[model samples]
Target: MTDIKSYMEEKLLQFEPYMLDRVQLLQAPDSLKEAMAYSLQAGGKRIRPMLLFAALETYGQDAEKGFDAACALEMIHTYSLIHDDLPAMDDDDLRRGKPTNHKVFGEAVAILAGDALLTYAFEMVASSKLYSAEQAVKLISMLAKAAGPSGMVGGQVADMEGEQKALSIEELEYIHHHKTGRLLAFSVMAGAFIGGADEQDTKRLETYARHIGLAFQIRDDILDIEGTEAEIGKPVGSDESNEKSTYPSLLTLEGAKLKLEQELDSAHEALASLNRPAPLLKAFADLIAKRNS
Candidate 1:
């Protein structure tokens, strides 16, 4: 099996240039394009796109075939980050080791850049010549649901509402499942569609994605408490400072760590249910469990 680190790094090299070139061609105002490009190029783990490509690799499909959807997924993720950093939201001033979009581009231009990225994401998928009508439809609809009111947006609202309030474990799960998990889930499901997964196959993979998604969030919460600003690319204890409920706050630090392990274990079990080798997908679960940034 290829080393997951090596595999991920190699894909990152290929994908960054590809996605940036597409952004460079957008015929928009200079300030808008610059804002968009700045956030897109800012350092990130690129976990969503990597998850999509991993799903494709699991099915023995060429990873390149998923690039359009991958880029679309990343764009949506970037847009969310931009909006989340606004004065009205998380009010963060830093992201991925750089100034937040609103801090760099001014609030108006930053908001517009976020809007552009969100809208352009759909165009990236819908205009793809590679997918069949059915595939394109499924991809677009999954992405829409994952990122829309029933998914990420809904979670964001719930998260905002839950701030400074003690939430039950179930309520917390709902917030994370939709906010982070849904889009992460879409990454895997979209790849499954591209690889022609059957209903059963999709179910198993979706299970894996959802578990890893939770695991990913738990780790982020832990990092907020334990990680240095240099490693996490933001100030530590931001969640605590905001009076937001997080895994570590609800479950003790040890409990959150245990929860993270449980989620990763479940993700592996779901992959095992596939009844075939899926080294890359399995490795991704490991990545989510262990990633410090």
Candidate 2:
């Protein structure tokens, strides 16, 4: 597992130059460009990109072929974080052990940075040499749908609306599905499509991503209650402070842990059925459910 993590870190580092090069920082307004670079370069786990690479590896495809898709996914993820940390949203001041984008850049600049990244992500996908025209178009369409109103953005809206209000389990699921799950689902599914996975294989991978996505959020909720700021790189207990709907808020801490385990089991089962070895991805799912950060 440690070896896999190290390998992913190395691969992600290799992709960074090409990733940012796709966007013309010089063309953007100076302030916005600075802000975009700040947040986009901030050290994150690079989980989405890693998932894409792992999925490609599982399919015996060239991981480099998924590079553009991987970088585009990271761009979308970074944009979401910038917007999420705004005063109107999570109101967070820290991320990845550094000040949030809006905290360093003004709110306007942060918003613009996010907007720039979002649009640039599409540009990266469209212009990538990583896939055929048909594959690129399909990947772009899937990514746009996942990042757009019906996916991550929709989930963010639901999360904000549900705040300070009691939410049913189903409503909570809806929020997680769009907010956290869609991008994850897209990460795996896009890799499958790019790697030429068949319908049966793609469906299996989607199932795996969906279960782990929810479990990832559930673990996040638990971590908010149990993880330290030093470990998580953000203030702990923010969920409770904001009266946010979370797994632990609905279920006891122990119950939430149980649910997480159940989700992991389901995710693992789906992966196991694939019969294609994916130790790295499987380990990643476990890490997500068990991580302190």
Candidate 3:
């Protein structure tokens, strides 16, 4: 085994300074900057960027080459979380053991902080010196679509609409795939693209990403029901309180576990097709499958 937990921590430590450098206190008001930095620095697993770098390394590319793109991915992700915690969305209070952006900064400033991070992500991508112009354009387009209505935003809308309703498995899958899965897939695919992976390898990695992505969302649902706030860093049972459809709610806890296993198997199958070794990727799949928080 690669000791993936240690590797992940090393990579996170390597990347944090770069991330902070990108999120500088510029001409923007100190308050807005504070709000943006609050969420960015609060820190989660940073799994998306970790996946990007891991996939890049898998393809024999320098992870540093994808640095800007990795940071951009985290920015967009943080922006989404800030917005997701708003009163209009999931209305969350605590995030990663800290008050949400809206809780500290007011909803209006929180919204602007999210907006700032979203726009800054593009700026970082566009300014990437590592990629050629064509590569930059492609990466930018990939990110926009992944973050846009056809992807995460669309999924968010579907999730909100499906709340309080008993959505079919297919409908729930759609929401999970679009809302959470797309970005995760993008995280993996973005690395492949940056590393100039061949068409076959690209498709294979995408398949792995898709499988893991769904599994990630399913694990999230399981955690919401089974994890305590002290462990999860947020309130549990919010799903039932909001009358939201979840994997456990629809498929039963045992059934959801089975689905996660199925997805993990598919992910492994996809990785098996790749010519290169993927110890980190394999470890990541297991981590997502078995994560408690």
Top candidate on lDDT is: 1
137-203 per-residue lDDT for model 2 (tens digits): 8998899899899999999888888889999888999999999899999988987888778888888
Write model 3 residue lDDT over 138-163, tens digit each, in one string.
99999999999999999999988998
The positional error of residue 83 in candidate 3, measured at the CA in angstroms, is 0.9
TM-score of each: 0.98, 0.96, 0.97
Distance from true position, residue 288, model 1, in Å? 0.8
Instruction: Please say which candidate is ahead in TM-score: 2 or 3.
Output: 3
Report the C-alpha displacement of residue 120, candidate 2, in angstroms. Answer: 0.4
Candidate 2 yields a Cα-based lDDT of 0.87
Report residue 227 deviation for candidate 1 (angstroms).
1.1
| Residue pairs of candidate 3 with colliding backbone atoms | none
Worst 10 contiguous positions by lDDT, candidate 1: 1-10
Arranged by lDDT with the best first, the candidates are 1, 3, 2
Give per-residue CA lDDT, model 1, range 128-147, as digits (tens). Answer: 88798888888999999999
Clashes of 3: 0
Q: How do these models rank on TM-score, best leading?
A: 1, 3, 2
Give me the runs in candidate 3 sitting further than 4 Å from their true place. none
